[model samples]
Target chain A: MHIPSWLLTFCEYLEQTASLVVLLPLGLAFWRWPRLPKTMRLMTVYLVFTELVLLASSLVELYRPAWSYGIWHFFTLVQTLLFFRIYYLTLSSPAVRLLIQFAAVGFTVFAFLDSLYLEGLQQVNSYTHVAQSALLIGLALLYFEQLLNELHITRLEQDPLFLVSTAVVLYFSGTVLLYVFVNKLSAPADYASHQVIYTLNSMVNLVQYLLFALAFWYAGRTLPSQSRP
Target chain B: MNSWLLPVMLATPVLLLLALGIVGFVLRYQRRLLRQQEQLRQVRDASQQQALEAALLAQEDERRRIAADLHDGVGTTLAIAKLHLSTLGQPNLTEEATALLDQAIGEVRRISRNLLPAALQKFGLPFALDALARTVPADGPTHVIIEQRGQPRRLDPKRELIVFRVVQELLGNGLRHAHAETIEVSVDFGPDYLSLQYRDNGVGFDPAAGDLPPAPGTRSGLGLTNLRSRVAVLHGTLRHDSAPGAGSKVWISFPIPYLPADQKPALTTSV
Candidate 1:
């Protein structure tokens, strides 16, 4: 099925500009409330890395198309590590922490190997994307379970960690199928389908960033602390 | 399995593991919370017990002070007044004035004895109870009987006074409220504990209804509240057996700590 040209153009515009709109307030919130949990502060740093990579990749896509894949691959590697670190800090169980650590190390090694020998820097790193999405979805579900088990939470909407976990679960679940089928759909004949599928990805990205912004706003209202274990 | 089903199978186990992990975490967390709450309750109960003990001790000290004031301050003055009246020569004194002064002295002595029974400190609990039984006038409609079992042994003086006061209060309640004809007081000494029993043929009220006097500010059950508190202070139990139209029986027992050979009392056979 074909998407309307006007709506597609609008989605593209939102994809490009959503981060700036979301990040400005989120940055201000972090600046206003410096006592956010150590994990959240680290997440702010990861967000800065994401924005920088996005801008660099956009510029490279316009001028040097060949290098954009390399840039994207590198950013994926870093983002996976940062996501693992965030979960490691938030979770208290040693077994889960160990599982995440093993997954992070295994993914890093696999990505290194796939980039060098198989996909190289020119192809989409679909393997790493699929693995990362699946891992994140699982972690997000675990986080929700933990939150529910807590004896009390004053307001779930105001809980920054709850918002962050929701964003992760929603975005990763939305992209799991697209990442799994990326290689099959990369042929030039499938260009229109690719554009439509990626537009969905962009829309998911917009929601994810908005959720992050809301989480930061909640964080600004109070010091970031874990709910009862 | 279909090619598409491969990821589904892999993801299924991962999701299950995550759920199991969280359930385990919650169970451990809840157990920890229960233990903390249990510890908090025990601490609160211990502090409350300590406060009750302090209040009981303070009450006994205050009673001793008031009793001394009545005996030394009031009793001495009334005795002096009686002596002065006698000193007036027989020719100068009127029959009416002499009888009035004698009656005034007797009333003062009675009040002083009620405040703090001097017999409780001088002798032991059995002796004090006997003296109390004698106070119910023999001519009155009510008959008083005193009974003792096992060799009588002296307890700690303070404890003896507490037991005496409890009995005295019971007797007073019987005379004032219970229109009974027979009041029997008995003390039994065992190897490890002592028991005091009071049975009266009074118009017994319902124990369930708590017919005792109301405390000053609160409408708590029967006047046994004070008796209950004293018994608690002694680490003892107070049981009341009564029903409407049936005579009331109160039984109180206190554990006796082992006394040193030097502190043990010489045996006494009679009440």
Candidate 2:
């Protein structure tokens, strides 16, 4: 569990600067391309919301760690709901849309109950995190399948939804097992191991957000002419 | 779990997911390329079809103009000359001179008809085709037969001209190239289509080879190309079946267009 000092510093820097690196481009894109697809615009809003929650949670953690955990747990549930809405918009099938809606609602309820009764606000919400990651991974895979099935997209690289879905698949699949075991790495004795795990998680977050920036930029450049419902 | 196995286990799925993302992007890129290729093909085909239609329309216009000139200009002068010759009732006129003047008038009329047949515009397709069949020498090597299977229907004038030209080209090809003993031209008016079949027992050539050198004393095979272009303008199908030593058969089918009630009366009256 011995953590390297450089790794801890790198992780801290990533956590502190992620908002600027990720959210700035997305916000600028939203500003520039007011006519972007509804799903893309909502994604930018969700990302800004996530950054706000991260900033607020960090401040709360400095004062009271337990309260910060609660905020994060609530944020996780909100993020899942937002993602479900985004996927619901992109996907064409009614059956899949209904399934995602049901899963979103079910997961929100489960995360709430798990935070209150099972994992509690003091501990890491590892169970809900793992479940969210698993579900997002499934949705990402489904989005790719839908992409292939429809084959209507003329330029995949320029499609904001396609780019965001690719980022989701990569980041969620990479972090699913890590999140599942995050609680184990939370002990005071495992501080070093926790930092390492979190650092890896931060790296994944950085890559995911970079992809989001790319998607937003693509939308800003192309969405005015290519807007769809 | 072994400490070493931890990163390895984590890295495996991450790598796999990254690989999957790459594959998804590659697949999408390929799909985009295929879509672009198909679109390009469709555009090329559309332009080609447009060009063919324009050329065919211009050709039809030119033929009509020439037909009018031959009829009103040269034909009128020939009629006047004949009238003037007939009025000369003097004994000085030799029988040879009288017969020669009559022959010259007949030649002018025949040339005028060949340029644009008056029967085609005045009567309709069947009469025009019959007149076409009559042009073939009765005692010549080829015997031409015209047959109608179903009830004849008059089509739009433009479409009728297209069909007429197609048949004309096919018949001309058969007589000039096939060197066949018999040529049968059949017209069938189905409820949904107007079908024409031209069959001739001549020195047929392979249609797949396309535009092979004609036999001695025969012209090049440009008529079939023109025939195909004319058929395409009507959105029709033209099939040529032939082999060397066997006769050639050209089948042309054009869809029957739905005419408005007002147009139907004119077509029926014309028929």
Candidate 3:
């Protein structure tokens, strides 16, 4: 795919502008105060992973014809997979953890195989995106339900856990909407038609990054008070 | 420019801003409330201490007035009566009459001593406490035991008096209301704290469900508020634990910031 120059410029803007302007402060917070809240820690980890994806996509944008879309697609796939992994680890159920690990490994293998040969099959790619979106929503829902149901969690509304979880819901809902609907209904056949989608996607990334910062702030503040053994 | 995408795109900013506004308001409100609560607590503690001091001073003045009246007026009258009685040898005075007159003198002396223990001024708090403890009857259903632990350091006279009165009130309450089978009173001295614990195996009241109003006449009723005030002056905390069908326990701990280094073991000075 000979990607359009305008689309390339937009991706580069997101890659550089969002990384420095959005993710940098969050990174600083993570560095300066390593003892972030649980929510913040999880959000930072998620953002760092997403930032890596964006950085990879940026590189792909600059390289143009030499690098295939498959590379960027694979980046998204791996990031989403890692996100789900983070979700499962946080819940900390031994049985669920084992189950997610097994499922993820199998899914990664399948995604890699699909990336190698399924470029001609756009529908397969779409279906894969749908699956990732579903997983994100499900993980978000599970995290929310756990936070709400915990009886020992006094001052739940003020809790960093609740804040970070709310952020996660926002990011998940926004991302799912973009992935599952925007491309199908709005993007034209040409790469130029996808510019708006790219811009919207960057805006979503910006929102996600900010929420991640909040999560970090909350986690750092609360961790010492609870003082888990 | 699809109608659907337009509405979603425009609403996002407003929703995000609204959420931020709500968060800021809640945080500010909580902080303000916390500050107000702390201020209120300090004010309440200050007023309570002032009232306790005024009450103690008034009580001391009343005690002194009673002691003076007994010594100057009553004591002189009794002495005159004794002198006149000794002169009754001039008449037909029987042995029974002489014995009765001698008993009256003994009773007068006992009353005068009970009214004011001269040892309280000379011996200080530990001696006074021991004297009071010795007077506690051992024949009741509740066997009261007193244990003084660690080195006893001398406290200010006013503090000692307050402690004495508080302990007396506690003993009275236990005997009258608690119907306790056994009562153990302990004074524990620590490096920076002096603690008193009164434990009784008695029919306790539910702190949550029981009457929240202060019990009148009992130490817990009238004297506890005063006791708390005295403890507060010394930066202390008092806790009471009781439950229906269970026993009652009172724990009071206050700072002892000025204990002398060479204090002796005050615990062994018991009846």
Candidate 4:
């Protein structure tokens, strides 16, 4: 395939820019440090972890490019754990919280197994991405159900957890398919030519971060809400 | 474009739209549930108010019947017996018997009046309240003062009874429980509202702890429950402030329905 150089450069810049965009939300999360609730504080931790992972991955890519996959494999598992904790705090149902616990355990084991045996550390972890998307999307659906059942949050848009859930649902659903074909897309022959494909992940990353920024902003200000029993 | 790329592009929007559609449906469904919950609350309140009104009206009817029995049936019989005793020939014996009869008649009259305030039906709430105050011992430890303000127009008959009962209960409570030295009761007839204020300098119970009414199944609890029901039925507001050592103050206001000037009564001001 004769991929254009300009097009390839554009995709590279876009991906790098998307990677760095985590700073915007990280800054907002720090600005509202004192008032962030437990769930939001967890989210801030997730943001910080993401930025660190991205930086370290880049550093490792320079000296030992193959080891970068291991860092990402670890990132995938931790991100799911954090999201599970966030949902656990916001949700009221004992049954759902129990489900989250079970799912968290199940996902941890699956992700490790997939990295060690199924996908290996050499290739993109498409299996882990797909599984993470499915799990988070399911959690997001449960959260939306919680919102309806509780009827406590009068303003859905202003609720930080709700915004975060919406973002999770949007990002995961929008990018799941692209991730499914990622291994084939990243084949060595087509890796340089098919840089445009990864741009989809960047676009969704943009949406996800903006939503997170909004979530952090709302967390800083006190909005009318009731504590879930 | 590769065969896999075409399917990914086509399916991504469908999946995104599916998620969006679910979110939108939830938003709409939640709003509807909220609306339904609000309507259910309003309905519950309305039915509760109606039940209270019916019970109160039935209570008043029973009181009226008992008063009539005391005044017409028992009181008349006692008076006739007193008249016959005075006709006895022995002067000393007649005098003693006649005095005892007089005491009996007076006690019956007092009981009858308490059961049903004739002044309340004939005169109005202010006259009835005045009569209520005079029933308390003037030289006793508790001294009650009644003050009426604004142009005292007549209210609905049932409303007048409620106002009178509220004052009666307050006075009764002051004498029985409050142990106050001075109790002041004020009624204001505003242009569109009727306000009642009662203040007592006594060993007050804590309103914050809900000791004024106490808990259910107690006498005070029943009294407060009844008082609250009456106030709620009229769509009125009730406020009570008190502490262990500090005095007690209660303020109640109701939206008044005014009567024409020609319908006003010409009752004397005497307590």
Task: Arrange candidates, best TM-score first.
Answer: 4, 2, 1, 3
Which 10 successive residues of model 1 chain A have the least lDDT summed? A220-229
Displacement of residue A35 (Cα, Å) in model 1 is 54
Per-residue lDDT of candidate 2, residues A1-229 (tens digit): 3456886788788765764677665665667567677888788778778878978987997988759788988888888888999999888899999999899888988998999998998877889988898888788778877766655565776778877887787777767767676676556666556666666676677778888887887775543222221
lDDT of 1 by residue, A6-101 (tens): 876776676667655667646755675566777677668778888799899989989999898899889989988998998888877799999999
Error of 3 at B104 (Å): 8.2
lDDT of 3 by residue, A1-229 (tens): 2446876686768745655656554665667465764434555666666667667767876886346356556665776776666677677567766767776776676666666675432322554565666666566556555543333343445565555555545554554545555545464454443554556656666666665555545554443222122
Report the candidate with higher lDDT, 3 versus 4. 4
lDDT of 3 by residue, B1-271 (tens): 3434555455555654554554455445545554565588789877887776676667766765676577677766766766776777743564556566567656655555555545554565667667767777778677888788887667655566556666666776777777789888888767777789988887776666444653542222334566666666566788888875577788998776643656532432211
lDDT of 2: 0.75
Q: Encode model 4's per-residue lDDT on B19-120: one tens digit a residue.
A: 788877877887887778768879998898898888887888888889889899989998998878767767687887778878988988998899888888
Name model 3 segments beyond 4 Å from true.
Answer: A1-229, B1-33, B67-118, B137-143, B178-182, B201-233, B241-247, B261-271
Q: lDDT score, residue B169, model 3?
A: 64
> What are the Cα lDDT values of the candidates?
0.72, 0.75, 0.61, 0.82
Task: List TM-score per model, in order.
Answer: 0.48, 0.55, 0.47, 0.87
Candidate 1 vs. true structure, TM-score: 0.48
What's the TM for model 4? Answer: 0.87
Candidate 3 clashes between residue pairs 3 or more apart in a chain or in different chains: A36-A219, A36-A220, A37-A219, A37-A220, A38-A219, A40-A215, A40-A216, B215-B221
Task: Encode model 2's per-residue lDDT on B159-202: one tens digit a residue.
Answer: 77777888788888788777789999998878778899988877
Name every residue pair that clashes in candidate 1. B212-B222, B212-B223
Which has the better DockQ: candidate 2, or candidate 4? 4
Candidate topping DockQ: 4
In terms of docking quality, model 2 is: incorrect
List, for all models, the DockQ compared with the true complex.
0.02, 0.07, 0.04, 0.47
| Minimal lDDT window, size 10, model 2 chain B | B262-271
